[model samples]
Target: MQLLLPSDVVRKMRKHMFRAQRREIGGMIMGEQIADQQFRILDFSVDATSGTRSKFVRDAEQHDLVLKEFFERTGKEYHRFNYLGEWHTHPGFSVDPSLQDIYAMQDLVDGTGGVDFAVLLISRLRWFWQYDCSASLFLRDHQPVRVNIKREDPNAKTEGEL
Candidate 1:
């Protein structure tokens, strides 16, 4: 499996991850899945803070507002970029999904509409956010199976770069 993330998404995630080094932070991931094994991360939110040093939860209303506004502003034609998954940081420990984390993914997938599948992206970053997306086995085996993160060209801006 492969997960392609935009440089802008990487930049935003790293900013929040670096700023909140002592606690955990999280948000929703928006992207599209291509073929049997490719997920392209087009956008994400990072301001939702519901966590301690070891765990994090997303702010539902904040997430909803972001998603609603993003989709509304972008128009429905570009709505292929909907809810792809969740992304959070493990402040001090490994980025591997704990049993609890895997369980939570089930709820997210059930509630999220218009998607055949979802992913959980974890970052084991200290000063930088290293995004890692996993395959479906994450929920089955209760562990994270990482995929590739392909970046955009150095000179080119990400899809929605401003």
Candidate 2:
């Protein structure tokens, strides 16, 4: 499967990461599955104050509000638009999932009433407006798989943008 991240969303994430400085920050990723094997990241929540130098735990309540608003605005399309996964900054570290990160995602997908699969995006600011990121897909009872992430064309507009 392929994940498409819009430039605008990256810009917003960069700003949040930059502002957090050495600390890690993260939030929920909400988007749409545009094709059978393609997912487009439409929006995300930034929990700027939820992390420290080495760890970040998302504020689900805040993220839930964001997701609720998105669902309402999107006319509650559950099949197409829904919660995709989570993302967080690594800051002064490599953009690789820590063991804790891996376990968390695995538990999420393995839990009852949880999603069959989820994506985890680990990123760190490299320079101004530039970031190093790693994407992984976690599935229930399966090993994590690396996912290809592509940046959306700046000139192209998706339905969310319109």
Candidate 3:
């Protein structure tokens, strides 16, 4: 299924990935959409101190703190933004949601009503994966619909802009 994200948001995500590559590290952000489906990216956060080998550590207390602070600071930026969820990366392979990922997803579901969001995974193979969706009883927990993407060709510029 095709994802219905705003064109501007997609562009910014692409741009962020490029920057992440330059620093040899992964990045993450939070976003939300109103009931009408209008998307707003609230804030971008990352553990820049960690690199490709960044451990997918499973620390409940630490995770809670991160999520809490994230919400407290930026939850009010949008008319309807909440702790919509997080994004992270993988050193290799497609950024498929792993088992640990599912657990984290479940935490979000239990903590916040039942909101869906995006998770981005950048691969060392020069590809990126985007997962977007919500949680449901019939669906697997933290299941993200993946969108494989390619960058705009610089040589084939669009319209009057670069």
What C-alpha lDDT do the candidate models reach, one value each?
0.67, 0.87, 0.45
- 1-162: candidate 1 lDDT, tens digit per residue: 767776777787777887887688888877765656676777787764567888787778888887787677557535355676778877777777777877787655455434445677777564455544333323332444555666654577643211
Off by over 4 Å in 1: 33-37, 110-115, 126-145, 156-162
Q: What would the per-residue lDDT of candidate 3 be over residues 1-162, giving only the tens digit for each residue? A: 221244454455555555555333433345555446434444544554444444443333545566567667764555455443455555443445666665655555555535444444433325453422222121235454554232333354542211
lDDT of 2 by residue, 14-74 (tens): 9888899999999889899899979999998889987999999987788899999989978
- Kindly report which residue pairs in candidate 1 clash with one another: none
Ranking by lDDT: 2, 1, 3
- In candidate 1, position 45 carries an lDDT of 77
Model 3 pairs whose backbones collide: none
What C-alpha lDDT, on a 0 to 100 scale, does residue 76 get in candidate 2? 99
- What is the lDDT, from 0 to 100, of the residue 130 in candidate 1? 53
Least accurate stretch of 10 residues (summed lDDT) in model 2? 153-162
